[model samples]
Target: MRNLRQKQASLVHRPIAWHVTHWSHDVYSQGAYSTLLPGGSPAHRAALGDCLDGRLVIAGEACNPKAPAMVHGAWDDGIRAANLAVRAGARRVIVIGAGCAGLGAARHLSAQGIDCVVLEARERIGGRTHSLQLGPVTVDVGAAWLQQFGDNAVAREAERLGVRLVGTDFSQPLAAASDGPVDGIEAAWEALRRGIDRRLPLTEGVARYLAGLAPAEARATRYAIEGNLIIEACLPLAELSVDSLDEEGVGNDDHFLPGGYRQVIDHLAAGLDIRLGQPVARIDWQGSDVRVNDALGDFCICTVPLGVLKTLQFVPELPQPQRDALAHLGMGRLEKVVLQFDRRWWPRSPTGYLRWYDTPASWVEWLDLTDAVGTPTVAGLIAADAVERQFSGRSDEEIALAARDALQAWACAVEAVR
Candidate 1:
């Protein structure tokens, strides 16, 4: 028994909170990989295999079959596309979208003495992986954490570039509230794994699957278990597919970049012919020549996001299978609220993450930034449809108040439990 009654009087040590709204089209929508809908990775395969008349090449995390939706996947795919372009006897290549994939391809092409240009829609280098300066410390607003540092491409790159990584404790929840700890969380987790092992081709969503097991009798306990799953999937429990969840697979030694993910972008974008604020509307490709917007190239590599690609038109419209694949793939919405405080108020726990069961699914996980940056700042992540449904219409102040209230309730609950 620990002394939980030693909670601070005020829930928040600081009144400043930064609400960053990441739209589906601009930053990201379909995070990492698509939900294993009816026809899962087949669509991804079709898109990757079907390159417009051999003149246009598709490269991005989505095109990667083994590791889709990962930064390293996108990087590797760019190199793969670059190799394809070179094999096709292309002297010059124009890479669309200066994201990780696009920048990666350009870097490889440039190294091979192949002329290439990177066109980005935004004025910045990183697309979704943006590092924002919050108060005295700088934190990554998007794509902050990296799983399995050992043998991981992104991790290797970070290490080679001299970026620091802080390990995270995912074994236990840092804090739980209002429901007196909901003691059966671990058992519920084990039940989920058992259910997964038993019913393999689980076409159903996680919500119904877990409900059948009746892992945790308490509603709060169930929420805590599901909340963690929801954050990982970045989708609502009902919308998430069990097959996709199983296929994604987990990594070991999860770590966060205390120096931010922007370092990776900077390292990848060194000395490349990058053109910013270039929103390509159309791509016209014939036998040996391809035109991106207005630029001409022997071959073109398209690396724009699925959300952005959905809006753009290809001259010889993509094949039926490719169109179907794009239609079936969905974008995962995420909302982050980062707060900086003057003093550290939360207890120092080995588990770096916190979850509140009573709160709506929208505001579920909070990552403590105190250890990483030596500042009393915390980031609250809200994923799935919850971002648009719960926090879209609300103002920053309202969202901040709701979050503060939730934290207060959790703190008060901990005190009561002790």
Candidate 2:
């Protein structure tokens, strides 16, 4: 357990005790789960195994390694799983969960002339990519940006669906610590470019080492460069299996869509049969045909999130290896706070503001969203742990106040620039 001071220090802004308690109460009331399991991986499938009586198969983004934790990645996996099940002669397939994965599965199955019934627990579709209206403007509470969109299926699908693509303006000026202008913003960008360049050789070297091919097979320097790229992505080059890298490297550069990412899910859900407000409570796979029970009639999907499956009681129990793998597969937590400002207060240079505070409770990075949206009414502040804590016990007023202070400081810094 972290001490109050330590916890406060970790936040982007010092949170009041009352706010913390209030946030905690809100979390409990909402039944929000803090621990995350990486969505979109095979861990769920492995855990469920052949328990689905050969009639049921699980497929979702969580089952794919390369696309783990991504919306389109999950959708692609869902489609593949549905296709596999259809080929196996399963009739009247059911898709559990109406998120991107489920919708993707439904869409693909529909295209292939397969019948699929989608069950969504929420009133609307799009799972984690949800949009909410704030003061006459609809904002994304979930996935906002498409990341690298061109290479992404969601981006392509969005384009096909007439969803507009917007490029993020990276030309905004940035402010640094203590409400000071970041003099090194340009230098930092140059250094980052150089770092990436420097890392390429290292990546290539590691790739060669794993392939067991002679350094002469590819320039040793090239292997080193590739190895460094892998490392930068948080995967160690030496430990990365060649097969895994080959599979994972399929799509690297993708674009982000404007409006909201949820549009893709909505588009996918259109024309598909979906039962909303239905949550699957249990799964009985002992029978020849798998059964899933919710408020609505029981239906089965080939795949479910490992997090959901882990809590579910399996009569025969899961295999040890599968269970262990599920346990080991970690999930990352990301929170986005969109601050609606009265006006654009930050610097307008290409390099945006990034602040590092001596205190733990200050925001680490703030980005200008003015260009993404027509108005300068919104800015995004990202502080991982602090934001998580903020969700615990703080009131909306308190959270807003803290955000205001942080933004005010940043605004001051921006104004200081000539």
Off by over 4 Å in 1: 1-13, 25-35, 42-50, 183-187, 193-221, 247-251
Best by TM-score: 1
- Give Cα distance to truth, residue 5, candidate 2, Å: 21
**Could you tell me the C-alpha RMSD of candidate 2 in Å?**
9.7
Per-candidate clash tally = 4, 57
lDDT for position 265 in model 1: 84
Q: Give candidate 1's error at residue 414 in angstroms.
A: 3.4
Instruction: List the pairs of residues colliding in candidate 1.
Output: 29-331, 29-332, 30-331, 32-69
RMSD of each: 3.7, 9.7
lDDT of each: 0.69, 0.50
Compute the lDDT for candidate 1.
0.69
Q: Kindly list the per-residue Cα lDDT of model 1 for residues 1-418, writing each as its tens digit.
A: 2333344343344446465545553443335333444345544544654556657877777677666666676777888898888788789899998877898889889989999998888888877678878877888877777765564677888888888888887667655655466566656555665555434343343445656654345353357445645666566655544445444423356788887888788888989999998888888875568888778998999988766777778887877777777765555566677777777666555666776665455567778888899888778777776677666577777777666655556656655655
TM value for model 2: 0.67
User: Which stretches of model 2 miss by more than 4 angstroms?
Assistant: 1-53, 169-175, 178-254, 294-299, 302-306, 349-362, 379-384, 413-418
Worst 10 residues of 1 by lDDT: 1-10
